[model samples]
Target: MTHFAPVEPDTATGESADLLTQVKKSLGAVPNMTKGMANSPTLLKSFLALSGAVGSGTLPAAVRERLAISTAQLNGCEYCLSAHTMIGANVAKIDGEELDGARRGESSDAHIAAVLQLSNTIAENAGDVDEADIETALEAGVTEEEIGEVVANLALNVMTNYFNVLARTENEFPVVSL
Candidate 1:
C-alpha cells in the first residue's frame, strides 16, 4: 500500500478540515477516499463541486450509482467499488443482483443498461467514443441532456477511481467484490 494515509477529520486543518467536517455531516462519516483526496485541498474542493453538480443532474440516483460502480469496476478501484456498493444499496436502494450486474456493465433495466454502456464506454475509452456509439445510446431512450450528464457522471467516477487506485486509499465502507 502507498504511504498516503487519510487525513483524519479530527486532525485535519484549513480547507481539508472544513471539507471533512461537511462530509461527516452529510454521510455521517468521512469516507477514506475523501480523506485521501484531502491531501490536496484543491483537488478535494474540485471533486466536491463536481460531485454536487453532477449529482443534481436529471439522471436518477440509481442510475448515477450504477454508473459510478461500473466505472469504478472498469478502472479496478476496489475502494470505490466498496464505497459505491454501500451507497448503491443504502441510498439508491439497488439490490444485490443489480449491484453485481452494474459491476459487469450490465443491468436488467433497459434504460440503466443503456446508461451503463455509455458510461463504461466513456471510462474505458477516455471519452473518445464515436458518434455511432452515442446514437446507440440515444436510440435506447437516452436524451442528449441525459447523455451529457452521463458523461459528467462517468468523468466524476473516473476521477475518484483513479485517485483511489493511485493513493491506495483505505476503504471505510463495507467491502464489496467484483
Candidate 2:
C-alpha cells in the first residue's frame, strides 16, 4: 500500500483535523480516495476546490454523471466505477434502468446519450475525440465549454482511479452493482 492512512487521519490539533471533519461531515464518512488526498492537505483542498468548481459549472448534473461513468468505464477503474455509480444514482437522482444502463455503459437520455458517446469515444481512442463527435455533442445542448468540462472530469477521474489502484484505498462500502 502507499501508506495512505497517515494522511487520512493526522494526529494534529488544528487545520488537518478540521479538514478531515469537514469531509466526514459532508460525506458522513471519509472515503479512501479523499483520505489519500488528505496525504497532502493541499491536494485535498485543491480537489475539493476543483470538485466545487466543476460542480458549479452549468453542465447538467446528469450529463456530467453520464460522462464521468463513461470515462471511468474506459479507464477500467473499478474504484472509480464504484465511486461514480452512487453519484449517478443517488446524487444525480437518475434511477432504475437509467442507473443500470449507465453501469451497463448505456446512455439513459438523449442528450446524455450523446455526451456518453463522445466521452466513450474519447476514452476509447486515447483522447483523440473525432471532430464530428464534437459537432454532435454541441447539437445535443452541450456547449463547447461543457465539452471541455467533460474532458476535465474524465482526466480528473483517471488520476483518482489510478491512485486508488496504487494506494489500494479502502473501499468504504460494498455496493454489488459497482
Candidate 3:
C-alpha cells in the first residue's frame, strides 16, 4: 500500500497545483509519482527542473532512458521501474531485450556498455567512483560532456528512486518485471 497518497491535481494548491498543471500539459497525464511529489512543492519543482534539464541534455533519449532503467533497478524502485519501462518502450523506443539489458546495466553497444557500467559504479559508490572507473568510461569514448550528463541523469534518477521508496508511490504505469 502507498504510504503517502498522491495529491490529486484538482485539490493541489500554490506551486504544487501549477506544477501539476504543467506536468499534465507536457506529458498529457500526471504520473502518480509526480502527484505524490506534489505533496512537497520543493521536491516537485526540483524534480521537474532537473528532469527537464537532463531530458534536454546531450545524451540521446534512448541512452538517458536506459540509464534511468539501470538506476531504478539498482535502487530496486518498482515505481520507477514500471514507469520507465513504459516510457522507454513508448517514448524512447527501446526494445524488450535492450530494456532488460539496461536493468542489468548491460548493453550490446560497447560505448553504451561503458556508460551503463559507469552509471552502476556511480550509484553503487554514491558518486565516490575512483580514477580507474573514470578511465574505463573515458577509454570507451564517453566524452567529458557525456560524463557530465550521465552524472546529472544519475542524480536525477536517484532522487526519483528514493522518493518512490519513501512514498511507496503507487505504480501507475504498466508494471514490468524487474
Candidate 4:
C-alpha cells in the first residue's frame, strides 16, 4: 500500500493537472510514479526539468539508461529498475546482455563499464568516491564531460529512486525486484 496515494490526473486541478496531462501526452501514459509525484506540482516539474536537461547531455541514450539501471540496482529501487529496464531495451535498444550487465554495474564496452563503475561507486558511497574512482574512469576513455553527465544522470535517477521508495509508488510496469 502507498503511504501517499497517487493524485489521479482527472481529479487533479491547476498545475498538477496540467503537468500530468503533459506527461500523458508525451509518454502516452502517466506512470504511477508521476501520478504520486503529481501531488506536488513543483516536485513533478522539477523532476521533469532535470530529466529533460540530463536527457540532452553528452551521454548517449543507451549510456544514460545503463547508468540509471546501475544506480537503481545499487539503490535497490525496484520501480526504477523495472522502468529503466523496459526503457533501456525498448527505447535505447540496449541488448539483453548489456541490460543485465548494467544491473550488475558491468558492461562489455570498456567506456560504459567505467562509467557504470563510477556511478555505482558514487551511489554506494553517497557521492564520496575517492580519486582512484575518477582515475579509473578516465583511464577507460570516459571523457570529463561524460563523467560530469554521469553525475547529473546519477542525481536524476537517485531522485526518482528515493521518491518511488518513499512513496511506495505502485509499480505499473512489469515488476522487477532486486
Candidate 5:
C-alpha cells in the first residue's frame, strides 16, 4: 500500500498539474514515481532540474543507468531497480548480462566496473570515500569529471530510491527483484 498516494495528473492543479504535464510531455508517459513526487512540486522540480543537469554531464547514458541499477540494488529500492532495469535494457541498449552485472557493481568493461565500484563505495560510506577509493578509480581511468558526475548521479538515484521507498510507490514497470 502507498503511504503517500500519487497526485493524479488530471485532478492536480497549480504547480503540481503543470509539472506533471511537463513530465508527461517530455517522457511520453508520467511514471508513477514522478506522479508520487508531483505531490511536492518543489521536490519534483528539483529532481527534474538535477536530472537534466546530470543527463548532460560527461557520463554516458549506459553508465548512468548502470550506476542507478547498482545503487538501487544496494539500497533495496525495488521501484528504482525495476524502472532502471527496463530503461537500462530498452533505452540504454544495455544487454542482459551487463544489466545483471550492474546489480552487483560488476562490468566486463573495466572502466565501467571501476565507476560502479566507486559509486557503491560512496553510497555505502555515505560519501565519505577515503583517498584509496579515489586512487583506485583514477588508476582505472576514471576521470575527475567522471568521478564528479558519478557522485551527482549517485545522489540523484539515492534521492529517488529513498522517495519511492518512503512513498511506497507502486512499481509500474516489469518487476525486477533485488
Candidate 6:
C-alpha cells in the first residue's frame, strides 16, 4: 500500500533489521514511517538519531509533542498525525481538547498557542513566515534560540510526514481523539 516498499522488521536483514530491532526495543514496534525510512539505512539511522537528539533537547516533552502535532496537522500527514496524537496524549499528558485545537491552528495556552501558530506557518509556507509571525512567538517568550530549535524540529517532522506519504505507512497505533 506504500509508494515504496516497507522493510518489515521480522524480515529485515543486516543493519536495517538491526535498527528495526533497536526501534522495537525502544518503542515496542518499528513504526511504518520508520520502516519506510529503512529504504535507505543511512536515512533511517540519521532520522532516529536526529529525532532522539531534538526530543532530548531543552524543549519540554509536552512542548515538543505539541510542535510535532502542529506540523503534522499543517502537512496533513495522517500517519504522523495519528502516531503523535496518541503519544501526545499518553506520554505528553496534554489535554485532548487542547491537542485538537492545535490541529485547527489554535491553542488555549498563550506560549504554546504562539508556538503552534509559528510552526504551522512555517510548515505551510516552507519557512517563508513573515516577521509578524516571529514577533508573535517572541512576544510569547520564545527566544531566538528556541525559535531556531523549533524550526529544526519542524524540518524533522517534514521528513517523516513525506516518508509516510511515500510509504503509505500503515498505522500501527490507535488514533486518539484529536
Instruction: Please name the candidate that would achieve the greatest TM-score relative to the true structure.
Output: 5
Better structure of 2 and 5 per TM-score: 5
Tens digits of per-residue lDDT for model 4, 72-160? 89888999999999999999999999999999999999999999999888878888989999999899999999988988998899899
* CA lDDT, candidate 6, residue 76: 68
The window of 10 residues in a row where model 6 has the poorest summed lDDT is 169-178
TM-score of 6: 0.91
Poorest stretch of ten by lDDT in candidate 4: 169-178
Model 2 stretches with alpha carbons more than 4 Å out: 1-3, 6-15, 176-178
Model 3, 1-178: lDDT tens digits are 8877888999988888999999999889998999999988999999999999998988999999899999999998988888888889998999999999999999999999999999999889878999999999999999989999999999899999999999888887888756
Q: Per-residue lDDT for 1-178 in model 2, tens only?
A: 5556645554633666677788888778877787677767776776676676777877777766766666666666667777777777777887757756665557647777776777677767888877888888888877778777877776666667676767777665445233
Say what the RMSD of model 6 is: 1.9
What TM-score, to 2 decimals, does candidate 2 have?
Answer: 0.81
Q: Please give, for residues 38-143, the per-residue lDDT of candidate 1 as tens digits.
A: 8999888889889999989999899898888898888889888998889899989999999999998899999889889988887778789999989999999999
Which stretches of model 1 miss by more than 4 angstroms?
A: none
| Backbone clashes, each candidate | 0, 0, 0, 0, 0, 1
Q: How big is the RMSD of model 1? A: 1.3
Q: Tens digit of lDDT per residue, candidate 6, span 1-178? A: 7777888998999999999899899888777778888779998988888888887777788887878778777776887888888898999998999778878767888887887788888877888989998998999988887788788798788888777766777777885433
lDDT for model 6 comes to 0.81
Which RMSD values do the candidates have, in order?
1.3, 2.7, 1.0, 1.1, 0.7, 1.9
Q: Each prediction's TM-score against the native?
A: 0.94, 0.81, 0.96, 0.96, 0.98, 0.91
lDDT of each: 0.88, 0.70, 0.91, 0.91, 0.95, 0.81
Q: Backbone clash tally for model 6?
A: 1
Which clashing pairs does model 6 show? 2-167
Q: For model 2, what is the alpha-carbon lDDT of residue 177?
A: 35
Candidate 3: stretches off by over 4 Å: none
* The 10-residue segment with the lowest total lDDT in model 2: 169-178
lDDT of 4 at 81: 96
Error of 1 at 157 (Å): 0.7
